[model samples]
Target: MTAFNPITISCFKAYDVRGELDVNLDNAIAYRIGRAFAQYLNDGKENPVIVVGSDIRPSSESLKQSAIDGITDAGIDVIDLGMVGTEEVYFATSHYNAIGGIEVTASHNPINYNGLKMVRENSRPISGDTGLADIRAIAERGEFVVADKGRVTLNTDKTAYIDKLMSFTDTTKFTPKKIVVNSGNGSAGPVVDELQKRLGDNIELIKVHHTPDGSFPNGIPNPMIIANQKATSDAVIAHGADFGVAFDGDFDRCFLFDEKGRFIEGSYIVGMLAEVFLKKHQGESIVYDPRVIYNTENVIAQNGGTPAISKSGHSFIKQVMRETRAIYGGEMSAHHYFRDFAYCDSGMIVWLLVIELLSVTGKTLSELVNGHINDFPSSGELNFRLGQKTASEISELLEQKYHSSNPAKNTLDGLSLDFGNWRFNLRSSNTEPLIRLNIETKGDKALLKTKTDEILAVLDECGAVSADH
Candidate 1:
């Protein structure tokens, strides 16, 4: 579609399209991506409709224009949703029966980060192993001609989406009181603020950095990072709210905290939400990432449903959710996907469900999670920035040296060693080049700690330097 050089274009990535600015990611790349998708998928129609949305990131606005140009070059009509969350982008795409869709966001990555997540017609995800590879190949080759030039127009449906969000739960359902939310100045701020305005103090609110700021002054907006969560945890304690909520850059995922300022493990949230969703939609399947508490499988089964373990990635989880028609799917990373949301992950939906559950039960977040806490003692994700490329070698060594004698081993996502009572999932970071280690024990916290220490020692001993960030 647009005439662009092949060498200068490389915004394509495994799960989506992301790269450095100018060098790898720029207007040219964005335009090429738009053109590639339009030409590859939506051709022929005078105005093949596609929904496009962008985040608050500085580089996104210009790049978004380039994408629109690309799409128009291929004779596609663009419904620009303007600045919104990635989930909203998905919602617009599916809601309007668009031929293709694109959401411009960098998510939890640093300030310099920028990227795009695209899907074919009818909200089908373009994942790495599935369709992203083909997109990448097209982007790399970068030699396509535009058959028709189309147009992009601004469309405002955020209010309609907000209405849809509130409609999920009845007004009389539950009035969760005194909950603190931290948006970290990401795109979720406005949405959360709107929810507060609409809900009108049904839940007491404590807002932290509610304004949008692409430069995450508090931190990188990732609540999983203890440092980034300091402000949120502190606010929860200061306000004595029922729970704390947080959102990353594009706000597709949400992380939580208990009343006592304790960070709630994502594993517990998955179990709680699974139970709630399954209760509403009886006998449905629930999808979950394999890196969470093993008890999640038991909880889903006990709730009169099926449990499907998926790889640790939004794209993969989404794929599995669609294939199984799972009512709910969650990742230990706080990315929650719902069948109601077209199998797309939504931080807002998960937290909304949480608020409803807490409101109806009149129980504190701590009380709700207490039942799921001791199911397993887990060493939350420990990241190591290996200066060497010996991650595979080290993983093999660990498997041969320790996991070899385990009761059973599963390498579905990475190296998952299962000893029946205690297990660990060693997985590599999808976005970053890091080997992340996770250890869990059914009834042994001491054993979990010991194993975690051993893995750290190995990382240090190997030909690499270790840094959590």
Candidate 2:
């Protein structure tokens, strides 16, 4: 048993618990967290039943066991859904009528990283504002009371989860197409294999790094980084595939590449999906993040659906979706949430819906997104490392510089300065000490480049270092 020392709060992030392993988060911390989470949900009348799942990270299994031990020690029953994606835990929590769920995963973080994502009833996340702060405090205190232990049951089957994912689309309407599915040796393999078993006849899947290996043999399973996409792009071109899809470590977020091996930004995909959902629902609300909005707003409005903007984050997006009763919600970072799926982000459902859109429209993935791309040429998210200036300092400088222009500033998630022809969002990352910048222009690639350069100059002047270093 690991000793009970106070764990650093660095692991308790805005949305979930995540940090470098051993340094801040470990089996001991996991166990303490489990006890704290159980105590939080336990009302004394009955023991809370909690669902637990884990990703393919090497440290995840032990951490999961420690958590389960702590929960059981607190007289909380646990159901272990072994080696599953984060969404599966969310699904299992609501599907089984459990009080809550916890998924052990680092989710696209470095191999040395690991963490937990917790949710309450109805798959609602437990973030800082919700329950994470309390949980963190309990864990750090390490003053858990001993009680009659509860039992744990192993139920590793993913059939129900896959069925739920398949329910989002019509398999009969799926046109036969050869595509590359890159799991990047993450937890996506088993789920993707199950999905293939259901639709193998219609979809020709070219598997790349399809095996689940916690070692992350394919360089971190994060396709958001341009270099990390090389394997998927190469496989797509080599196999003459229709398109390529890549999943993160926990398979909660997915990224896309075109048949031509060009990466498609997530903002355009959000717009495409808005149009798709609007066609079916006709007038349902669609939730989107405020970072890049023109394309999504335009498409949602044109398609007779309302576009609601929310602060960027899974917890924030899900809450907004529930409040607005939105049918769909998406972020530019590739997290897509569906109302049918308990408002939880699923990496599988988004790609499947895109495939369905492609089949119905008889258009290539590039064709589907090119119009939005041309309409809203954007500088994909650019991260600048903090130097002498802090994130707040840099943001203040940008606001001061642009304040006089009166370019329709919005301080929702960050500072969004909107000009008639071009706009930019400059926000500090919630998880990292870096400033994120996004610039987009209406039908003007030149304006996008010019504005991007102008922002880069400002960032440079504000003591920000390029991420390239």
Candidate 3:
């Protein structure tokens, strides 16, 4: 039996665990979290097993080993999937019938940080509302039931996962087209390579930064960062590709770019995917976050599907998907969830669907999305770094200013107000210390810009600096 050593861990987040290295998270804390996760899932089960994976971060391997140690110490066998994306852990957890799974990945955080995203059986998310609080409490208490150590097995085979991805679209119908794929030197590179081999010769891929380097030689894998987008955009234009796709550190969320190197807003992609799913599964419920709604709502309504609104986080979206039996769910932040994919979001699956859409429609990526963009001109998610003001204070101030307009108001996730032809959603980010604002005007670019500027001015008055600047 291990001696009890209670230590406070501050790495636990609303959804996953994240913190700066050696400060809020370290080997000891990781070990405790692993043990806690196993204990929480054990529940009188015999020889419970857990799947573990990690991203390409420098600290991930060691942290993963420590976590595996903790799980094993709790007498839970582990299946290590080697270095892989977060979704792979999700898939493996369900694929192997494991009781739980954890992916040691900070995913687009600064190089100095690393953390874990965990899930229970059947790839169900383990957020604060579910089992994360209990796991955290167990870790903090540092007490465990004595049991014989469990064994660890190496299972790096991704054939099953690759097969699952290919099942989303028929490659036979995929027209011969060139595509620029920028992996940003993260874990996506290997997955992309494997996908390329399976894709055969019909699709030509122009790979950029397609190497897994923990040092982040190109930059952080987050294409949402304007600075990081230039690589994929430039490659798309330079190669005259059909379209471009880029993935974050863990490859869970992918960002798309048009042939003209224009970064397609995630809201528009959500609308496009909603249309795709609704066409195939008519009258089914589709879940979307309240952050950006006009385009998605319009599309779902047009396609004979019901639109179910959910909060902005993955856990909330997944729960709503299950509740509504949604055929698909999307967030403006590039997280796309599928009913068939265990209600888990996958960056790879999204791009594949986009590819199939393009092939089936025979339309340029821009051509396919242009109608939605024009009909609902939007200010794609502008983030503001708060100064001296909390998000709640700013929300109250904004409400005070806008509530007099008698617009339709909804606080499903944050503040959403619709004044007939125009609307906006102002909310705080779940992960970062920032406020996200999204606005859209019905086919009115002038109004979109004017309202965007007006909102920024009000935010400026509150000492909130634009993160884009």
Candidate 4:
């Protein structure tokens, strides 16, 4: 038996486990996490089963196998769903009646990093506040219960998962449209190929960097970064496609590009999706993040859908979606969740629904979102690298400065200050050392710019911005 090596618990984050490979995270740590997760899910029951999946990262297979070994060692049956996106693990967990699921993926991280996303039965997330802390503590302890090893089985049938994703909208209503899909050489290719095969003549799917390459020769599939978006935008322009879609490494979050080769902000997409859902199911609830709110609120109100605000993260969005029974939930970060799909976010399903909306409306992507963009012009999310002061400290100072006006404020996830005509949200990133800022003004582009600059000045005063910049 290989002696277990004790490792630091830093890889376990607020939402999922992620870190640089072989440094803060490695196969040894993965094994321990598997064992710990199994112990957590056992719940005084026998024959607890776990579904395991991995992305296309070079190190994912080795880490997955080691984790499986630890899980089986704890007498938990393992259903191996090989080489899949993170959402597939969530689907499999619910489909197979497993006690829990784990996806070995460092989603959208650099090539040198790898990690895991875990969930409990019914595809409910295991975040730090829920059960990740306990798993971290147990894994750090390195103690295991002696039990007979369990069985491991392999299953890669994604037919049901694909069918379920398509069930959100009627295919008969889909009109043929040429669209570009840039997989960014990540784990999304296989799933896209499968869905494309099912769609047949309904869409002209233009593929770019569609192969699943762990080396990420192009780059990691983070479309949020402006530099990383050129490929999708260029492809859309070159192909004259209706629109372009890009996915992260694990295909759980997706971004959009318009027919004119312009990157569309996720906030506008949220408003459009809310309208789509509400047109069919009026008075239903729609959940949105507090980052940029005017467009979503206006669209939901006009479409007769109740708007609910939630913290901006996959776990929080999914939890709030379930609590509010929201038909759809979207965040400016491009994570879209649906109540129909076990309240979990899925990149594949997002694009499919977008296609359905485009077909039903007979409008280009730009046309679909332009009205909202005009109504709620926004300064896209800006990140300030902190130097001396913490995000909370800066937030407090800004709050003091604006409190004299007695603006509507909420601290649900961060500092959301609504000044009637214009508003901004200042929040610290869950995984990084930067403070993110999002500002929006009602139909006033000039005010948007002025207020954005004003906020930057405030950040400078608060030492949230580095002095060198």
Better of 1 and 4 by lDDT: 4
The lDDT of each candidate is 0.80, 0.89, 0.91, 0.89
- For model 4 the TM-score comes to 0.96
Distance from true location, Cα of 7 in model 4, Å: 5.4
Cand. 1 TM to true fold:
0.95
Clashes of 4: 0
What RMSD does each model have against the real structure? 1.9, 1.9, 1.0, 2.1
lDDT of 4 by residue, 308-412 (tens): 899888888888888899999999988888888888888888888888888888889999888889989998888878867778888888888888989899899
Best by lDDT: 3
Best by TM-score: 3
Model 1, which residues run further than 4 Å from truth?
1-4, 43-46
Write the residue-wise lDDT of candidate 2 on 356-442 in tens digits: 888888989999888889999999999888888887777788788777888988899888989889898988888776778899999
Candidate 2 minimal-lDDT segment of 10 residues:
1-10
Could you tell me the lDDT of residue 72 within candidate 1?
88
Q: Against the true structure, what is each candidate's TM-score?
A: 0.95, 0.97, 0.98, 0.96
78-185 per-residue lDDT for model 3 (tens digits) = 999999999999899999989999999999999999999999999999999899999999999999867789999999999999999999988888887898999888
Estimate the TM-score for candidate 3: 0.98
How far in Å is the alpha carbon of 297 misplaced in model 1?
Answer: 1.2
